[model samples]
Target: MPAVNRRLVTDYDLQDAMERQIGIRVFEHDHIVHSGGAILRFDDRTVVIQAGVSDLSYFNRADCEFFELKKR
Candidate 1:
């Protein structure tokens, strides 16, 4: 009789060390603007972020709605 070896595929938890890094910053205030179809009154024309979708039509720019950040 011979022994058999088996490998597991769906029982692994991958983690990265860089993903758990955080740093502190000194700032009095900050502001950000995006083109995600939002409105604001006290942001000095800074628009709010809504969502992110994938359709292969991204403008590939920093001021586009594709990379907008939203609050959870």
Candidate 2:
């Protein structure tokens, strides 16, 4: 995990990430909730992340503590 300068906090931020095809890692406190996933889609309250080739993970926007953009 490299250093990230920006954190995705708003829906617009997530939208930008999705459009840019950026990878995101979700965390709750110091624990990782999701890792090495790309933004597949997002709504007002939830975000869907592509976990693997065919796996998708859903997360609530308010439940996530942090969304870190991974530098590829």
Candidate 3:
């Protein structure tokens, strides 16, 4: 885990914010909630997760993971 961007999204809008982003990382220990999609990882920067699949966390709820936009 790294320093997450507090300004990324509020607790009330986490899901929506992640949906909008082209690439976002949703970490899960058991089953991969979201997958089979394209993701972009910059040089020591952010990861973009393209949507259009099952919302893993939503279906089988879990602890919310932190994230950042990753400024270069």
Candidate 4:
């Protein structure tokens, strides 16, 4: 049987990553992907990310296969 319920990150982890100003890589498709300085915000269907120093990028949550947030 396959797992039904899976969580990528908790609320606390999100907050901590933001506070620490860490980097994250969001994997969308097998060949299409993007990464950035850190995650600004995320919702049920989308994520707002910081691409450059003062620029933000938006990605669809449904498109992501996985995401990685830096430890520190």
> What would the per-residue lDDT of candidate 4 be over residues 26-60, giving only the tens digit for each residue?
67667537665677887777777786878887877
The lDDT for every candidate, in the order shown, is: 0.21, 0.78, 0.39, 0.63
- Give me the runs in candidate 2 sitting further than 4 Å from their true place: 70-72
Q: What does candidate 1's lDDT look like per residue over 1-22, in tens digits?
A: 5533221111121011112211
Give the TM-score of each candidate: 0.14, 0.79, 0.29, 0.61
Who wins the TM-score comparison? Answer: 2
Q: Model 3, residue 19: what's the lDDT?
A: 52
Residue-level error in angstroms, candidate 3, position 31: 9.0
Q: Candidate 2: minimum summed lDDT over ten consecutive residues — where?
A: 63-72
True-structure RMSD, every candidate: 19.6, 2.4, 10.2, 7.1
Error of 1 at 24 (Å): 42
Looking at candidate 2, what is the lDDT of residue 32? 85
Candidate 1: segments with Cα more than 4 A from true spot = 12-72
Using lDDT as the measure, the top candidate is: 2
